[model samples]
Target chain A: MVPKLWNETIEEHRRAVREAVLETTAALVAEQGLRGVTMSRIAEESGIGRATLYKYFPDVETIMVAWHERQIAGHLAELSELRDRPGTPGERLEAVLERYALIQQQRHGHAGELSALMHSGDHVTHAEQHLRHFVRELLTEGVQTGEVRDDVSPEELAGYCLHALAGAASLPSRAAVRRLVAVTLAGLRPQG
Target chain B: MVPKLWNETIEEHRRAVREAVLETTAALVAEQGLRGVTMSRIAEESGIGRATLYKYFPDVETIMVAWHERQIAGHLAELSELRDRPGTPGERLEAVLERYALIQQQRHGHAGELSALMHSGDHVTHAEQHLRHFVRELLTEGVQTGEVRDDVSPEELAGYCLHALAGAASLPSRAAVRRLVAVTLAGLRPQG
Candidate 1:
């Protein structure tokens, strides 16, 4: 029983170290361009020994990929939580878009390089499908509530919403992003 | 008068040679990747002497940039002509989206490389502003005609239209693109 408890504690510690390494690598990549980041620097910034860091991630590219995966996972989690929140269908969608835009705003610099990295992974395709499904479910709810246009299928609208909100990633300010979201939401209204 | 005509003929020849060089270089880059292209190969492929090609363009990158400029110029011309076509505002907008999607479809195989080239130019920014203005004018006309929602500024809706239609560049098929356009147009409708 004691050995099993010790093994569980060790697993928790390993997980924490992995998390620290991922965060540190992302911060380093943000401060310096992806080309400038190195394994030793990540080890130093993350406060893990070089040997330990190697055990967690073999190279800087792997760490960046892992960090991006974590970022995507976190976004999906937030979106799912918002989707379940108490509100009208339209309100929930608006909330999700605003939150999504804020996240885009937060990811200002290095977006081009980061996007290149993001798409180079197989995980991106899966993540995109997950995001599309999430948006489609919300749109279906909105249609049922008569808040969204029923002429178009939810799948098409979900694709439109994603493509439209993508512009928010490059918008200059939060106010601009909010305006962008408003325009996207306006697009979802039932036809007069 | 004879010398003046000779000078005009010389200028025309220079323009033809320049256009040929640009086209040949683009074709070569398409056949092979950018790294395989060189000034000698471009001159040979263009059927121009190496020295004359150098006079027109210093290297492969310059030729590629010039080719991209011509492509953008052609697109802008097509879009402007569509914008002034005799139709209802909504019809004009749909025509523009269809043409735009066709253009995207035509640019299928080398889109990644071409986009990389397209974004590396200052002219792309100018082209985007031109496109946004073109879409904005259509939205304004649609609003006046009661075919579009008037609550949002034409500028905001124009942004939405561009972002939403940008997805056409990556869609797999013509029918899918048509569906995307229809959904985007639905977004522009007056709210019920």
Candidate 2:
């Protein structure tokens, strides 16, 4: 027999618990450095019981992976908006960098723990893999359109883009971040 | 009253302690994530007294800063080497990217942690600030020579570069990272 809607409601409640765990982690990470964050700490800060926290995340890494996914969704949305603007490929890419840099500057301090955690060292989550695949698709599209060079693959270029922006996000201000983004785009200019 | 070698000895001793702390924290973070790192844990792992560790780092954040500086130093060295090679601006930039991307692939696990820590919540350290300055200088030089674009500022571009590469570093392999770099560089090409 199919599970009842009440069962479905229970699943919905389960998801909310997971999301609550992630949301609470994000806020805590944004506030305290990663060291300050703990499941117990999250439990305390989130006003959820430790048992509830445990029910949602097996460990800190699982909770963080969820949190990082949330940030990635936001960033991908920004990337789509940036890339979709009407302009030359160079201008669009530059705009993406500028916009990304600005956003990063705003989110830098607030994001350190999750950014550090979503990275390697923990098990690769589906969201991390999915985001990579999505970004790779974006790069491949850039190449197929002749908007990008064919020599280097989309994956490598995506690395360069992420590495540069990670550095940018930690800078002191939007102007500084924008300058970095602009120059990096310039550096990427295709040969004569 | 001559403390001739005293300062040098003290500096050397301090350097050794600092490196020990960084190495230990790097190991701990690799095994346990940045949150796994702590002053007491580092002191225990490194076999240094808690007081000694405190004398050097005062907290987890300062030690992280030192470690990040060490990681960036590697990238900067690779870039400097690539810049010295005989090539047109386009060639050099591509070469530098190739070299740097390789370094990133090799150092991903460790350096990726440094990045994650750099992003983890609260108070930007001097090392983070310095990395931005370094990227700015590199990009400014690229722009001035017309090897890179001038329309976008160096800082904005650097932000994108950091974000792309750091994200790529978490991917499974070198081939994947290289493709992303190529596509991004390709997109930087100027329209005829």
Candidate 3:
């Protein structure tokens, strides 16, 4: 068996290589569209051998999927942190929705093709499920505090927030996105 | 120039052929999905000769675009008629939103591929503009009657309603679609 120190160093090197690969591919995709990217180009740009790149990711499509997974994970973590932070349930919900809208706004024109490719598969479904649950929990908490409407179930309300916020993709400005989030939140307010 | 009788006959025939082509192509797309459709199949199914079909549309894509245009026109007309019917402005708005939500609900799994193909063109842009204006007008009238919240602009509220109702596309039942419309309308109500 390898020594403990040797094993730790190897694992760290592997993680570093994976991170470099994901970041390099994302930058290449940004510079050139998805169609313009290739595995060999990624290998060259990342200063890794083509054979080694293949070992890490078999193709450009796989690399894109990995990058998208990383992006989704990061966004979820950010929302989760915001939800856990000190704030009223209403405030937390607003912060999470704003972040989500901004994320959608930033994605406009940045990855239309990439999104079409990445939106399929299990990862996306799982991520959507996780997101829905996260938002539902926040709304549920708000309802308990009398900050959210009781007429709608938290599950349905979660769907409303998500679908409304998705409109941010076509919005021309961050201010428009914020307005959208505000309107959505108003929909969640307790009925008078 | 042709005589009046001859001209009228030719115009009627042209319209009938155009309608048949659009309907046939839509049916083919529904039955076999977008990829499986073809110009020859459309011509054969519509009972129009290949030469005659070519004169009407250049290819399958053009036929699909024409079909989509007709569909949008029909939907816009339906919404307009509902809006113009005898009712209070608030009731008219609810009728329009409900109809739109039902349309989205019925569209689930119906022509997703066709929608992606048809969404990018000038026709879609104009249709969206018309829709936004229609909804905005309804909200403006509602605000005049003190039925809608005045804090948000009618234009922004129009965006919210549309984006929120679009959630109907994924809802599992007509009941759920109605519920979505209710939640969206809840956002439009005057704040107490």
Candidate 4:
């Protein structure tokens, strides 16, 4: 049996190694494109041996999926915090979109690709589904509260909101994307 | 001067060559990915002479861009006809998204390595900007006519809508995307 101190050290080492994989994966994907992502390449990028990397992540797909999950988790966590804040459903939706817009602006171009790959679609793994359900719940709550328009369904609105971001994030400028979102929100609000 | 008959034949030949190249490129991209795109491979796939292929396109990038442009053109043509249809702005927006969603569904699994290569801040080409503008204009017009909400900007709404589609499209079930869109649309409409 391992000693207590050794167990702690092993756990800490595993966490560090996992983080290293994620960081390496992101950098590799950002620079060399997705094909640049290989077990040996990631191992080299992370300064870990191939065997060690495999010990950490069984394959490239696993790492890719996990890396996506982490990025998504970060956004979902932040959005959930925003969701509970005091405001009407409209205000909350606005806040969420605003936050998304700001964060998206900083992502250069991968925001759409990454977001698209993660969208609440059929390929969604469990965590992606969680994000989908969370957003849906947020919209449904808005409708339930009567702060959001009743004529439109939350799923349809959520789909639009997501696609809007993916396409907007791919735009050349934040200004361009912002203008697009402004018009869409104007359309989504209750007509006078 | 070239004979009129020869000129017509030349034009027809050029069109055929372009189509062959496009088919080759699409198949290659679908097979080996963007990295796998090469002039020789395209020539091989399309059964065209290398010299003839070069006469039409100078480089791989140019060929791919041209091919993508053609794809955009088809979608744009569809949009133009839809715009002429008699409908409210809201109806038009819904109709347009429905068409887009259908197209997206078909291409759902096609985006992978090629997309990852272009998912950068500086990756927006002029054609992509033009497409975004086209969609944004549709949203803007919808808002201007008071058929859509005035709260959100067209750019933002477009951004949101695109994001929603990309995100939701990632799901395993295409039907889920449809449901999501329907729900979101209901949420977008005005309350009684």
Candidate 5:
């Protein structure tokens, strides 16, 4: 029992260190361009030793990619939690989109130098598939409730919603983001 | 009269040379990325002397920007031409979107190393304004014809359409492109 508890404590400590490294890498990338991100700097900022940082990540790009993966996972979890909230399917979708747009707007805050890195990764395809699946399921539910148009497939509508909301990332204000979301939601209504 | 004729010939030659330089730069970037594009290589590919090439453009980045400007101008001209075609406003909008999707798909072919360069520039804002204005006008016409939703403002709907169709650029096939356009058009219909 004593050995098992010691191992669990060590695992918890390791996880904490890993999370700190990711957070430090992201903050450094946000404050400086990709060029300024280095293992030593990350170690200094994260309060970890250089040797320990090297054991966890080989290079800056790898650390950034790991950080991005965590961001994507966190976002997906948030969306899923929103999706399961008690509401009509359409209302849930609206809530999810509103949250998605806000997340996109925040991501755009790091657009100048990190935008390219954000877009170029294998994780993009996986994340896209997950998002499309999530939205399509909600759309199917909305269709059954007569809240969304039935002529178009849910797959197509999912694509439309994602693409339409993508520009919200670059919008100037929260009001503009909300307006864009309204326009997108209007597009989903049953046609006359 | 003789000097006037001579000046006309000189002006025509200068225009041809400028066009050739732009084409050559684009081809080089397509084949070898932005890094391989140099004045010497451009001169060699364009069948011009180094001195003449330098006379036309000062640096590789400048030449690339000029080439990008021309591409934007060409796309705008094509869209405007489609807008003026003999058809109902709805039909014209459909035709323009189909062509725009194809253009976007073509642009994606060069997205690897040049995508950032393609997106960044003052010209992008100008092109976006032109596109939004053109699409908004068409939506207004459709609204008048009772074919489009009057609940949302034309400007808002236009933004939705552009943002939605932008994803067609990355779709896997022409069939997918058509489906995305169909979904976008469906979104514009009057809501019950």
Candidate 6:
């Protein structure tokens, strides 16, 4: 039987190896398009043996899907943290939206190939659902406070915000993204 | 040389043939998926001889592109007509937004395959530019009439409206799409 400390050490080592593999593969894909990446190159760049790399991920497509999942999780966590941060409901919503817009902006050009590959899976659907739910909850809280428009359902309002902010992917600058967030926020305000 | 009346008749026939080919190809793509379509099949279904079909379009891809371009032209003409219709600036803007949302909602499920094929190339770029310009002009008119908020530039607000209404694609009903349009229009109203 393995000792507790040894088990923990092995788990930590496994995580480190996985992290290295994911990062190396992403860097390679970025430097050379997705078509140029291969399992051998990922293992070589990651400084892991090909056999061990195979144990971690079966192939480039699998590695890419895993990497995309991790990236999406990170983004969701970042948004969740902002949502949970101390602020008025309106302020928190703005913070969450601005961050989301910036993320979209940063992904603009680089997202083409990766997005085409990564956007179709079950994981993407789940993440979108989670994101919509997250924003809906925020809008619900704001509506309770009379900060958001009460006429539109929070669910519909959340969808509007997401689709509006998605245009950030084509925006030219951070300022433009902020303006988009502002306009979206304006739409959510109480109507006179 | 052909007589003048004969020349006119020949031109009319050419136009009719082109229209038939475009419409038949679109119908075929809709019935079967893009992969199931071919030039010979298009020729057979369009009832234009293979040689004549070849004179009009060399392949399925060219035919699809031509069809998409024509469809885009029709949509633009519809929007332009709404824009030019007699109404208050606010009313006209709402009309355009509502129609655009309905179009998006209608395209949701059926758009996947066709959009993937037709969304590239210079024609799409030109159409998007025309669409943005079209909306921007409407917003500018609304702003001049003090119906639209002046805090954001008409350009930015136009982007917001287009992006927001695009959410209608995922909406489940016409009422939901109209609600989305209302929320997007709300964003354009003059601020307190």
Best by DockQ: 6
lDDT of 5 by residue, A1-192 (tens): 579989999999989999999988878877875767889899999999999988888888777777776776788899999999999999999999999888877876443346445563323646657878999999999999999889778887888888888777667788878877877887788777
- List, residue by residue over A1-192, the lDDT tens digit for candidate 4: 989999999899999999999989888877776656799999998999999898889998788778887887888888888888998877887777766665666655443444444442234767656755776677787778766555656766665565555454446676676665554455465434
The whole-model lDDT of each prediction reads 0.78, 0.67, 0.83, 0.68, 0.80, 0.83
Question: What clash pairs does model 3 have?
Answer: none
In candidate 3, how many Å is residue B185 off?
Answer: 1.3
- Report how far residue A30 has shifted in candidate 3, in Å: 5.0
Single-chain TM-score of chain A, each candidate: 0.87, 0.76, 0.88, 0.84, 0.88, 0.88
Least lDDT summed over 10 consecutive residues: which range in candidate 1 chain B?
Answer: B115-124
TM-score ranking, high to low: 3, 6, 5, 1, 4, 2
TM-score per candidate: 0.78, 0.65, 0.84, 0.71, 0.81, 0.84
Q: iRMSD per model?
A: 3.5, 5.0, 2.9, 6.1, 3.1, 2.8
DockQ of each: 0.38, 0.38, 0.42, 0.30, 0.42, 0.50
Docking class of 6: medium
Query: Which regions of candidate 1 are displaced past 4 Å?
Result: A1-17, A38-60, A120-123, A144-146, A173-175, A190-192, B1-65, B116-124, B144-147, B190-192
Q: How much is the lDDT of residue A69 in candidate 6? A: 69
lDDT, residue B150, candidate 6: 88
Model 2 residue A149 lDDT? Answer: 52
Tens digits of per-residue lDDT, candidate 3, B1-192, equal 779999999999999999999888887877887777888898899999999999989988788777776777789999999999998899999999999999877765537457544653223646767889999999999999998899878988888898798788778888888878888887788766
Question: Candidate 6 residues B1-192, lDDT tens each?
Answer: 879999999999999999999888878877787767898898899899999999988888788777776776788999999989999999999999999999878765434456544542223546767888999998998899999998888988888888798788779999999889888888788777
Model 3, A11-66: lDDT tens per residue?
A: 99988888999888888877776767888888889999999888888788777877
**Is candidate 5 or 6 superior in lDDT?**
6
Candidate 6 has an lDDT of 0.83
Model 2 has an lDDT value of: 0.67
Better-scoring candidate (TM-score), 4 or 6: 6
Q: Per-residue lDDT for B65-182 in model 4, tens only?
A: 6776677678778877787789887788777776666655655444433443343434556765665677678878876777655565666555556555554544456666665566
**Minimal lDDT window, size 10, model 3 chain B:** B116-125
The list of candidate 2 runs beyond 4 A from truth reads: A1-61, A70-113, A138-148, A158-192, B2-61, B70-102, B119-123, B162-192
Model 2 misses residue A132 by how many Å?
2.3
